[model samples]
Target: MQNNIKIILKIFIYQVIIYLNSILILDTFHEVRGYNITPQGYLSIIFCWISFLPLILLNNQKNPVMVFLWLIYITYIIPVSIIFPLINSASVYSIIFVCTINILFFSSILFFRIIDRITIPKLKIPWDLYKILIIGCGIIVLLFVISNPGLSLIPPNIFKVYSVRQHFKDNTPLLTMYIITNGGYVISPLLLLASLYIRGPIKYLLITISILISYLIYSSSGLKSIAFMNLAVIILYFYIKGTKSISNSVINIILYLFLTAGILYLIFDFYDPLIHWLRRVFFTPTLNTYYFYDYIYNNNSEFTTEAPQIVSQIYYGTSGSANTGFIGDGIARYGTLGLIINFFIFNILIFAMNLSSKKVPFELSTTLYLPFVYTISNSAITALLLTYGLLALSILLFLFPTKTNKIPL
Candidate 1:
């Protein structure tokens, strides 16, 4: 009981620190950028903290999902709230709206936490089936590399040039190639976990093959998110396997910070690559969101179409890929209420799979679910449905098989 009280008190203090840090950072950034922090922005930031409190306080399970979600929130909010104002001063309304949307998103997860306790049954997968799944995924990954040689090993010079251009002339990959490459995203996390568990020459072979396949897929596509997702999986697997404690999770976060800082330093040295990458990762989505606001308020237009369409229509002459993230897309299409409704459904789906992971910790379900959670923050719903969507369905079918399909004892 005393230990429980100490844990609760520690978490409470941590929450306070996070809240204070967010406010101080926002204030400092606004002051430095010659902008005044609005009352609405302050309220929104506080509300954001409140929404996340349930997850922070009530999560006795020490699920890695909380860690990933916290990281995503910090990464997303710090940049948009603090750094983004330097580019352009967003209106108080826009800032508040974004904050509220985040609150809803967090709330959806909390709702799942409650339901997860009651609804999810314990799940188990046979060892033989798990190995077969990993090997089969490995074969498919190799096949992808062999079939799409041109797309698989992109030249560094070409990548550099493409990065500088900030737009690929023929960015639309073949349907077959796209599908095959996505297999890497789906299985890379599984391979990492499998490497940790499986023994002998087979283990080394799986690790080598996974690394090679991941390299080929990321090199061919030049999508930073996929690369980042792969890296996150490897890092997270070690973090989970090594120390399943809150303190260790903090250390893992610090390590991630350093890794991110190192990448940022490299990006600065190679500004052209950074520019192209940021154009897709940060600027385009943000610009689209801003344009979306203008379309509705300034132009007296209703947001009937998707956020990407709005971005494409307003900001022409780029790489025609106008995929704003889930936040932007959700708000643009359905308004705040719509975003809440969609997130509720999304939360349930993700949480169900997450429960399966907890039942049999650090196995196939966990491996499959990690990549999905890592990438879901930044991806559009439609894009995820197309890519990770197929992966999730496969995981459900295999990882959590029906009793009828269960292997005999």
Candidate 2:
């Protein structure tokens, strides 16, 4: 028992550390300063945390999933951190991204339970479904690619380019909030791969073609970064699937990422032959580390400030396009502890929800989807929605389910 307590504490501490690191690591911004504690950002995080108390008390048992997740989080991150031609953007943010996904998983759990009273189980799958899914992806992606303007080749820093929104007037930033350092296009592959478990090849192919076309025409142009990210996604997805143990998965992810990088270099030589050749010859760890470190420490125009208007200006197109959001501000306000606490609280809620036996409510699922994705995407809103949005209300309603008062959980 004593050992278990100690182990739990260790896991808890690890999560806390990771959270804070994520907050501070990525200091990118479109504004001269970071976003301030406006009614929206501040109130949201606070309410989100408070709403999560039930998660702490409810799921309530000592479980290893949290610890394993944290462990896997760190392991998956370290391998391909090298060869980054751009800023690493909060090292801790990656973990935050994963933890935020709890909103989705947790809410789903709640939905299952609530609807369990009247809903039927529906998870049957055909044996040949996965092959069809893959083919479908290829077809869809190819169509999307061919339909839209095809890039002759993927470019460097393709990883960081996000949001296809362009400005019509000079100095006009788009009025959107989701622009962040994304592994954007790379995730497309994982989306393709996910169809593996589902039914249909033509479906996956069609889907891929659609995405490819959308990307070429409507999507952002940068895609080189996605190459590395896509590789990471494949590794991370498998790791998350838990087919391999944490240690084994991490080893394979790193090796495979490097291997993929090599293959990409050789195949992509037709595009930017010079740089590709250069990276092959001299993309050393020392250089990679030095540049990443410089980005985090040396660049700080937007890391320290908390002016809401400034943030709003850029977010609404007054200043400039913010490549990175309030990451620097989050780190400054809470340091690494901030990121960990945020993620831990979110993860704790998700674990609680998933560990539960049935589907959560639909309202909860809807609320959870965007926030869950947002938090994982390194945004502040996900945590808020988890705590105070429709999901929380849905959970409350679920706990006291109706004239019959059935056992939801």
Candidate 3:
């Protein structure tokens, strides 16, 4: 009982430090990016902490999935919620709605303990068939990369990605696109992980081929997240191998990454890539949510399912997608009530993820699932499963061989 109290106290302290770090980042947003962020006095601070209580107080850290989602809330949602009304002429309702949805989101994670207790039956494929499946997937990825028009294997500049992405999308058939993406994103990474148990030149070959294919996929798709996924898998593999604590490692990495981004932005005198990335990742989605509520819903616009697209079209004069959060999409699609709708659908994914994490090594399953989480801030559930390979990845996780069932590679 005493030890439990100490752990809770430590997490609470870390939560306070994270909250302060968010304030510092928001101040940078106001100063560097010219966002008009001002606190609406102590009440806003108090309300923000109130919404944050579920995360700080609840011991949801054992699940890395929950920890990562909370990281998003800390970095993106909390800072924006507090400053929205002050900057964008946002109404009290917007603040209340975002806060309520966030509270529910964080609180729902507490039920993961209950959910994890429900055992998910695993059906393992025969080792021979599994080997064939892995080999077949690798062959398909190679064919796709070789046959694709852009064969440079050199990743496009981040600024030039849209054009490259459009070209790739226009040429690739939808089904083929998904298959190849799953092959690269899911199959190759799994192959890499499985190779760790192998003992021979074949293991090195698998690693080399996997790395090459991942680079080719990123180069072809112009998706930066692909590269990050590879990095995430490697980091998780070694970290879990050493520490065997996925949740704590993930939480610390997220906090440090955010802190480093904020500190770099504060100290740098000139523009740099990290600053651009920091703005894009940390600020854009939250600011876009502000625009969504203030500009779209406030104008009494018709409820449209294409909220992110519409926001992108109107504000940026581009037909591309906006960086709208799930709640923003909810508000723009179905008004305040849509938050509840979005929450249910979003939690279904969370529940599914929690279930999968229970069956496989948390590091393997969670890192493989990271791409889907990366898209949640901007993507609908349909897009996540269909467009982003969540369904395929989930199946792979369920089928993944456990250590006890290991077969020679």
TM-scores for all predictions:
0.66, 0.36, 0.82
Query: Which ranges in model 1 have alpha carbons more than 4 Å from their true place?
Result: 1-60, 77-99, 119-124, 152-178, 224-232, 246-291, 302-306, 312-323, 362-374, 389-409
Ranking by TM-score: 3, 1, 2
Across 170-279, the per-residue lDDT of candidate 2 in tens digits comes to 22222111111111332244344434434545445534643553344233334333334335444545544444243333334434544455456467743232234323
> Across residues 1-409, which tens digit of lDDT does each residue of candidate 1 receive?
6655665554444433334433443354455321233323344344434434334433435654555454444434333433233333446675566566556656765765676566444445665676677767777767765665455465345335455223322543456455544656666655665666557777777777777766665666565545566677766666566765643355345445444544664666543323443334333444455555555654666656555655565655343445545665566666666566657656755565555455444434444555554345456665666665544444543464434443333
* Candidate 2 error regions (>4 Å): 1-4, 11-32, 35-119, 123-125, 157-220, 223-225, 237-318, 321-409
Report the C-alpha displacement of residue 71, candidate 3, in angstroms: 3.4
Best of the candidates, TM-score: 3
Ranking by lDDT: 3, 1, 2
Model 2 shows how many backbone clashes? Answer: 50
Report the poorest 10 consecutive residues by lDDT, candidate 1: 32-41
Query: In candidate 3, what are the lDDT values of residues 1-409, reduced to their tens digit?
Result: 6645654454444445444544555666555433536644444455555555555544545555665575556555654554454345446676676578667766566555557577767676665566566766777777877787765577989767877777788988877787767766777787788677566776777787788777887788886666666677887667665765445555566556656665675687543433456456555676677777766567888888777777777766677777666777777878777767877877777777766666466666655665555566766656667667777766666666654676674
lDDT for residue 59 in candidate 2, whole number 0-100: 28
Better of 2 and 3 by TM-score: 3
